[model samples]
Target: MTTANLHAPLGAVSVLRLVDGIMNFKTNLVEWNESRQTRKALSQLSAAQLEDIGVTRADIDKL
Candidate 1:
């Protein structure tokens, strides 16, 4: 309808969207990596040690 609107393409990528995607990627990577390490450590504990902390082997990934 307008000059700017008429010039716009269907496949345009905005700066805000690009920045948001990068930020989200970094956040997810950090969170997943931290959770993986924590789950690994919890899974390594003996059953008794796990009970002392009030978590069972089945609960490791659930947390």
Candidate 2:
């Protein structure tokens, strides 16, 4: 079996992981914002408008 080097600097790996986590957070935030906007717009629609789009008031919250 090969001996592992325990003294290696893991700065690069740690930085990459941190960047990945930040990017994931940003992506999720954007998606959530978009979903919120969609929900808001749907909620503002009249019954007839919602019916025209084949969506109901209950569906808005489900989305």
* Best prediction by TM-score: 2
Q: Could you tell me how far off, in angstroms, the CA of residue 37 lies in candidate 2 after the best superposition?
A: 0.6
User: Model 1: per-residue lDDT, tens digit, 1-63?
Assistant: 645545445545576688889999999999999999999999999999999999998899785
Report the number of clashing residue pairs per model: 0, 0
Question: Residue 43 error for model 2, in Å?
Answer: 0.5
Per-residue lDDT of 62 in model 2: 84
In candidate 2, which residue pairs clash?
none
lDDT of 1: 0.87
RMSD of 2: 3.4
